[model samples]
Target: MAEQKQTVSTDDGLILAPADEKQNAVASELEGSGISSPAEYEDLPDPDIGKTDAERAALDKALLWKIDLWLIPWLSLLYLLSFLDRTNIGNAKVANLEKSIGMVGRDYNNALTIFFISYAGAEPLTNILLKHWSPRYFFTGIIILWGIIMTLMGTIENQAGLLACRWFLGLAEAGLFPGVNYYLSCWYRRQELGFRAALFFSAAAMAGSFGGLLAAAISKMDGIGGYEGWRWIFILEGLATVFVGCFCYWMVFDFPDTARFLTADEKLRAMRRLRADNQTRATEEKISRRYVFQAVKDWKTWVYAVQYMGVLCPLYSFSLFLPTILVGMGYKGNRAQLMSVPPYAAAAAMTIFIGWFADRTKWRGYSNMAVSLMGCVGFAMLLGSSTPGVQYVGTFLGAMGIYPCVPNTLTWASNNVEGSLKRGVMVGIVVGWGNMNGVVSSNIYMPQDKPRYLTGHGIVFAYMFTCLFGGTMVMHFMLKRENRLRKSGQRDHWIEGKNEQEIRDLGDVRPDFIYTT
Candidate 1:
């Protein structure tokens, strides 16, 4: 059908007569899409831009709930195993690697530091490597690899053996977090991405909960012949990871269009729908060094990297020391391990609740800032509390705060960019670089710091607060920038398919896509 010319009033009140009707021709061409005035098109299907103002507002709310079910359990499960497998050593420290492996003063700390160093160094590179590999196969292979290494960790005859295993494990598992973040962006609308990120991230909380149980149970295996229970922790948990990773390899969906589960129409709608949500050329793969260079060139890449590194310092440190902290609370090794569960359970609940709230409100920065403050307050209370009950409360609050911010911030930056190349490359750079904080955090809490944990807690609180302030500032700035673009009498700028893929697919017609704050 030939297109008919129509005059539409811009958001700024300027009347736009599409100089060429072919422009946004895709919008006009789509059936049931209602190319008429925004008000008349109340039945349109795009989730990002609903028929009318009221409808668009409503769909934004629905997107939040739509994504919640899938994001929560999947991420939580993955992280639980990853976190447990990574830090079960602290529990093992109490179990007797100190004796069996001849771990002397500071040897354990060095072992952890090795994990973080390799973790940090390899993170940035994983983001890049994921682009060339199918995320399903890549994560699957690596996860299985780490699981095997972790199982081997159970047999360490010396600290050097333990150290060698950790370094390799670090290298193997570096890509999952960033890959998950980048993958989520493919499905949800921008307003809904933060909380989805939060939900996925809360697995850290479970690692604490289930991890403690696993440790307590394994510690009992002390002489089930000759091998210590700590050895069991690594073996059982590593085996679990191998299974889960393999399961994901067999079942994980890549994209809506390619998803074996979705119907043809569903794929079309999913693709078209997201195009409306993000006015960027983000469809399909186009990997190249030029694209990688372009991603590196963006200022937000550095900003995101900095933000991630800052929070991770506190997070990794806290994960490594929870057992010690509980021990400091006066519980025996077994009981302290059990007690670690509650705080993380609380964190899991908070992460889901906060993520839902962020999606419901269509506000990313507010959700993250609030969570960061929660971390700060939680950390503060933890530092001051000598009472066991009060310390548990403080730990709960801190977990709540730290679990969600990085995911939200990472999504926020990713949503701002157009194109799969920029998003993938930049997400990798920022995510990989940000994780470098694990290196800083791993060493911060020395065994000598014990009870008060003054130096470690103090520095962690300081860094988190900085991220809170910095993330909030950047969020608002982006908000203002988006508002300016939206009101610039550029209606075409916001339309679907005018973005990166459209520019690439149809032509270089990058409608005035605006970045959110």
Candidate 2:
């Protein structure tokens, strides 16, 4: 089919084509995108109106590099600490946290389950606070709070004490993952978000690698200060986290409009680029009850939530159990910790590459579906195989396949949502609901299923398969059909009588707000 010609309407409501080849070229860029009226068209000013294509590209590259240097590294460090602190219980378990605390029967699983209960419950509410308090203050406060909680965890003498610490830790950590994701959406364009999100998320993969090596080294510190190796692990890592959190107050930038690192020209371009990127809505908007209701009403929000749940279930299972799985593979003590590093290291490399690939191809759902299949195959191997070597290989495949899907899935959801408040609400709900899958993961890798954890492997395999066929594929087709309808002008009726503010407030409900599948 030929590209649809874009039109504008004047005060008299006369429809006309763009005046010249330049305006036509500009309009053609948003071809099939349902821009509601001439007013909405004017809102998305051409970023390259005066500059040559090469000049615009060069400037964009330099600006992105500056943004990346300031944003990605610090955010990645924060998440690295958060993930390490959250999952370090697994490492602590390997070092005999259960034996140390006299945890018996289901006590270990209960501890893990309690964390997620608090975590998922706190997630939706915490993102609201992120906007209210500002990223710098909010992140610094939570990071320090969690760090203190984690440090005290080292001193816990019993199961009750441990559970209490874990619960508070969950509340403190509830914000960081989803908070950083929403924060990223504030600065980057749709196409740029996936790769940046990947870079930030890959830090979690690196933390897994780092955690294993660090835990191995720390476990040797047993009896150094009348503390077990696991105790030392918590104390040292907690201190490091607190240090980073203190630095975050200075290092973390707020939104782009108020970013201190950018020049006046750079700030203007940053805002303009985002306006051009999201054609139908303002780049930034105040939080409103209406947006919260709109986000809750959007069916796409729930679909994304379910899709996120599918991937996170298996991802959590794999991350929390990999060391135990390796120990079951016959690697003992610190050696088991050492062996866990390779899978996460491989996963970190693969995640960054897949993120770049997804952004380059603009194939978020497709990338997720493909990776989900890889995860299914990996879990199938773990379920079917008897040999330790085969199961070890499965770990590599599982880590690599599952890790990348997170950033892709998140960016896919963020890409489709318009306006800041609505996007934040949608992301918060999706993340909160998705993280509830951690409960399922924590309980499934039962103590009875050790060595050949068949039941756990089978269930996680099913989850990954669901991510492939039931989640990403379904969402892809839904978005594709919506785009097709908008291209045919079938959705134009949505904007017929709305004024400019009404149209802007309608956000993605507007006909021309194209969906990125």
Candidate 3:
């Protein structure tokens, strides 16, 4: 009479039968176990259960590869449009946004801060919303809404109008990182998440690089029909977002269950694989508020959030001002825009290589730690030198070093949390917390302070130190926990039963949640 709700669970890969089929499923469960309630017998895992560490590791990598294919193009396009719209005003300043809108010093930065405030507020709600809605439609619609807002941003005539648009844009874009994190968890095991995240995360670099080139060309259209070239950046890119968002609605799969690409048998295999990989269904539980509140009180939440907070001071400060910094090298407007591309391109290159290596090695924390070192060194080199050749090289390295951590930090924190709701909430909280640093970043590079960027570099130097200290300690902490679990042999519990509570309490019980090598 109704469209039957087809389903699967990690416990048994077979499509879960309706109430009528429970007799059959129980018969099957009993066939091999010779036990009625699996709980009574301790529900020991099958002897032929999953691959060995090496084999499971390979499977994890393979699964990561699939998640990457689904995530990268979609997430990248979303962030590219989201970020391009957010920062295009920097490019717009080149085409006279300040003059056009009668904006004075600090007004633009203030506007950026306003966006973060709304953005930060909206992030937490995403974890709850993402659970009920199909990530495919939810993710697409959010981007489309933001895109519309971005296009509207182009028509602003005054400071208030521009500021209003930016605020609305932030509100619309808030759910993305948390939403995507929840989406990826539906597919990826913890170990493989970082590289996949990096792939999608690196889209920010592509946006930065291509954004400059496109904005430069668009700026040339300034005098046509009383519209500025800067305005066109918003109009064109925003429209592109709308188109892409709509397309993803048809293309993006909701979950393993709803994905038409997989066959019925394939879906069962997928669920079983995840079960062996130690992931329980994130979506099966009740709605997430009570769990979210508990998650907020956990120590790991603070630790993960703080680790990222350390990086945010440097990462956002660097990304937001990189183009403005390039303009100081005595380059022409077009040249400055073009110059922004190379350093970001280098970052993009670094992100891909290291991300792959991280995946292959299955060491999320270590990978991020090493890259953070590179970023620190790169930023340091850039800070100490003034020669154009050296400075240019330093900027490239700095970029290479800094941005790679973004996706890694996101993955690192996310992988540690269990449950769809808890992961979603924590991811949103961590990102929202990171955005707070932007307020500190906005004025760090004083209008009068250029060429040297003394204050800004000092801030970055301190933040990098924090990242090194916090990140290194956390990595060691993760490794120590992993080793302890291996020695004591409590790994089975992690694979089958433990949910959010177990994960939070016994960091060592990280069965297949490999510390990205």
Candidate 4:
């Protein structure tokens, strides 16, 4: 059958063309309308311009709720397990896993370091592969693999066995974080991302709080079936993760276009709504090497990575050491585990609230800076106070400040990038770099630095300050400068006269692509 030709309007005028000629027609129309470059096309009317406000609002609410119901819970659960399995070693350490395994000196730290090294190293490659595979299969496969590795952790008879399990565990878990971020971006608009990202990330905070309680209860099962409580912690939690993965495999939605829950009209509405946001369109475009190269060349990826690292190093240390910190503050056994719960609980609540606020205000960079300052104050309190009560308060402040920034930074990177491949690569790079600091975190606090851990607190404090400065500079200088250039009629030649596919391939460097600050 012959292709049907159709008439479409552009800024210049209406033109008759085949459906497949849309890009060329639009480009010609744009060129004829004094829009010589893509930068000048920023003011083009939204693709959803025909929709009434009432219609849009109703559709948006319905679509968002549907997505929230179908997507967030499953993703959050996955992240929760990822965080729990990774950080459960911390809980186990306090439960005497070290004595059982004969881990001495910096051996525990080395185990943590090795996990992150593999975790960070595998991220980029995993993300690229995720782009090629079905999200449901890819995600479920990794979760299952990691769950198996996590279960094997309980069976480790020596440090070498533990180290090998952690290494493979990291490799299994590497794809989830960045892959989910990129996946979410494909479905939701930038403004809607913060809370969703938070919704996903607050699971980590929940894991911290819940892991403590679970570990405490499981610790009571020591010497059961010839397994210690710490061993039971790994075995039980790992099994639970595997169970969830198996159950939720069918619930995972690939993208808006391929979502099973949505009706045909709803699917079209979802895609149109995203396109109207003037961001990258969600499509299963083949992984392009050019997009990967573009993402690598984009300085924002590295900048965001560096900024994220400052937060991650401290956050990782905190997650891995909070129980120990509580123990040092005079809580003992199950009491210390229970005591570690409140801070994470508080952080979880604050993470959701801040995510909502950031989305509402559309000021991600400012929100990040504010949270970093809060973290600085929290660390200051820890440094200044010797009293346990005051230090416990510091933990609350630290948790609140640190946890929110994770989602914020993740969303911020997703918001600024365009194109699936570029976004995927960028998310991978940023998250990979951020997690790389887990190495630094692992070694930052030694066993000798117990109780106060002054050196650890000080290092985190300094990094918080660096995060503040970096956030400020990026918002005021980099993003602002790009916005100004585009607003002032300056054009990025890279996108000039490009067809739709070419422009999409250009990612955020496209002249019309405005960076959200």
Candidate 5:
């Protein structure tokens, strides 16, 4: 006799059957709704009800492409601007920002540290409120507000003024990174998210390169319009950001359920595909204390948070201090800015490729570990040699190592977590805490440590190694073990007598919800 496949029926209209069985179940449910034939519902025919596998696959591909075109490019642009504005302070520093403003003795680092402190505090609250506020309006308002603040930064005369601007800039800019992560999770499935998220995140690397080139060009404008080159960096970039933010009000979209770009049938198909991808977990749009508690109590949340911390420390330090490092390596002012471009360009390419590869292999944790080793080697090269050429090469390797790990880890966290509110909260927790490492990054590469910054390189290397052998490794094995227990039916007892709502309330802890390794 053939083995039987176990199935569970639910009162919430979600059928917990295997993939093939679930398709048939969806069709049956559609037919039962009294609109079996297309003629009966001509205005809004069911797209998936009677489709063949090939037809469905084509539709899926087309829908995904449409979504990519609509969401990725604009989001990437926004994040690029966000990153450019955030880190151009590095470029300004090399252009004598501290000297012009009378900043001395760790004031620069304090400015950097203050931004991240405000950033970490505001991140979680912004994520929780994102769904409640319209993404389009919310994104537009924050972008414009930050742009105004950054533009005002150009006029500041002292460390006090710069610190105040940096604080509010952090508050205004905190929403975009985590907000985009949560936003993309709602559109893409577990398997498809890695590449899409990477595509969006690769903008940061691109921003690093672009900011270098742009700064090199804009620096020539020193004393033009009665402002120094450093001030123009903030003023011009800030104005452009405001322009983009204004345009975003017209271009940005809300969730799929209300997306005006998709037709009614396409929207239905999008929801259905995500439903299947999620193993029938209904997308929870509303927030409640229950989901918040579930997110905070989950062990995986803290593990991913630690993993993210390991990545962000080096990543932030490199972006914030790359130009200065290049200058330290014997490059002149404009040459230092120009040299910052190539490493970021290389990192951007590797980041996109690894994101695609991670999705294909479904080996997110391993991918993170691998790239982290590359970063280790890069930092080691920096510490081992004093030659400018070798150190330049090390910058390339370091960029490649740290940049790609970000999207992979983010996708891993988003993939395993179920439901909107829980995932949002988890992302907030992970990203918020991870950003706190910027404090460590800011302080490590002090002025006195310049010529070689031994402490900075060693500390970054240690953090990258931790990403490889510490949090990421442990989380990978622990998740694998959990999957094994679930496969052995060890978790079935929790759902044995529970109703649909009870089991649903279990969230990712439910037996049917298998984790992605």
Candidate 6:
């Protein structure tokens, strides 16, 4: 007699019976739903259902391309503008913004610190609203409001006005970075996300490069329209951001299932692919307090947040002070602005390459450690060398190292987490916590410590090394051990259910789910 084959059934009514038994079991399940037999089911031309592996892969590739075309450019543009607006004050400071606005003492640093306060505080609420409202409306509305605030920043005549504008700008912009991150997680699988995130985040590096060039060009616009060049920087960039926001209102996609561009079959295939990857779908699950609490309690969320904090301190300081640093190295005003561009351009290229490599290798943690170590070396060079040329090279090394690690850190947190609600909450917590370094960074490099900011460089160097060690230990020791336990048949207690949502609600703690380190 032949050995008996085991059978399994899924909550979705899919039957995993032997070839001969499969048809009958499937037919029996469908009979209750009015499909009388497997023959009739097979006769239906439902391209979305029952696809072969080759066909599924082909459709997934095509759908991903369409998603990339529709999503990445708009999001990248929006992020570029956000970063430019946030850091343009640095460019403006070089062009006499402080003198023009009568900012004195630590007012500039205070202005920078105030932005992060509102930004971090509003992050969780903004993420909740992003889910409640559609991404199209929520994201566009955010951009428009921040653009308005940024434009008003050009009109400020005093420190108080500038502070108010910066605070409101932070509030308006709080949702965008984390919102886009969570949105990407909904569309792409873990392996695909690193590159997609890099494409999205490279915009920030591009913004640093482009903002320099734009500031250089606009510096000539001084006294044009009775406005200073710094004023023109804010006014023009803000107005352009508003225009793009209005245009993207009609163009930006929401979740995959609700995206207007995808066909019925494509939408079905997209959701199916995502479900197959991690046994979860990006459906509009109820916003449960339990999900938020679960994400907060996850040790990986806090560890990754701490690692991100190390990256952000140097990144924020670099973006805000690169022009000033270059000027201090004996470059003239316009020369300093132009000089700031190269490091950021190099960073953009490195970020894209590293992102692609991380995805291909599926080693997010190791990739992050490598890049972060490069950042450590870069900072060490800055601290040890007083030569202007050597310090300039340090900036390039720092840029390439730090910027590439950002996308990996983000994807690491997003990849390991499960469920839309849990992932959303986790991303918001991680990003908001990580941004606390913005406050630390703003205060680290003061006017007294200018010309090299040696103290600042030392602090950032130590932090990068901390990030490397923390990430390696967690990945190699904690996550690896957990994977082993799961593979060895040690399972966490979980509730069994006939409903898919119930199982998905278990989130990352579900026994079958293995974290991507």
Query: Candidate 3 vs candidate 4: which has greater TM-score?
Result: 4
> What does candidate 6's lDDT look like per residue over 402-450, in tens digits?
8988888888788888788788898898889878788988888888987
lDDT of each: 0.69, 0.83, 0.68, 0.82, 0.84, 0.81
RMSD to the hidden true structure, all candidates: 6.3, 4.5, 8.7, 7.0, 4.7, 5.8
The TM-score values for the models, in the order shown, are 0.83, 0.92, 0.82, 0.89, 0.92, 0.89
State how far residue 136 of model 2 sits from its true place (Å): 0.6
Q: What value does the lDDT take at residue 340 in candidate 5? A: 95
Which runs of model 5 end up more than 4 angstroms from their true locations?
A: 1-45, 279-284
Off by over 4 Å in 3: 1-71, 478-486, 489-517
Which tens-of-lDDT digit does each residue in 136-175 have in candidate 3? Answer: 7788778889889988888988989988988888888888
Model 1, global lDDT: 0.69
| Model 5 per-residue lDDT tens digits across residues 325-396 | 888899989999999999999999999999999888788888888888899899999999999999999999
User: Which is better, 2 or 4, measured by TM-score?
Assistant: 2
What stretches of model 4 exceed 4 Å from their correct place? 1-53, 468-472, 492-505
Tell me which residue pairs clash in candidate 1.
124-432, 195-355, 280-500, 281-499, 281-500, 281-501, 478-517, 479-517, 493-512
Q: Where does the lowest 10-residue lDDT sum fall in candidate 4? A: 31-40
Candidates ranked by TM-score? 2, 5, 6, 4, 1, 3
Better of 1 and 4 by lDDT: 4
- Give the Cα error of residue 194 in candidate 1, in Å: 2.8
Residues 1-517, model 4: lDDT tens digits = 3235454544212233456866765664333221223342463343344666566667668878989999999899899999999999999998998999898999999999999999999988777887677788899899989999999889999999999999999999999999998889888887889999998999999999999999999999999999999999999999998898887678887788778899877776676556545455556467668777888898888888878888899899899989888887888889989998999999999999989998887778888888888888888898888899999999999988899998898888888876767888888988998899999989988889888989989988887788544755665478878766654446445555678777655656655566667
Per-residue lDDT over 298-327 for candidate 2, one digit per residue giving the tens place of the 0 to 100 score = 999989988898888887888888888898
After superposing all C-alphas onto the true structure, candidate 4 shows an RMSD in angstroms of 7.0
**Candidate closest to the true structure, highest lDDT:** 5
**Candidate 2 Cα errors over 4 Å, as ranges:** 1-22, 25-53, 279-284
- lDDT string for model 1 (95-175, tens) is 777888788888888898888778767766675576567666777778889999998998879888999999998888777
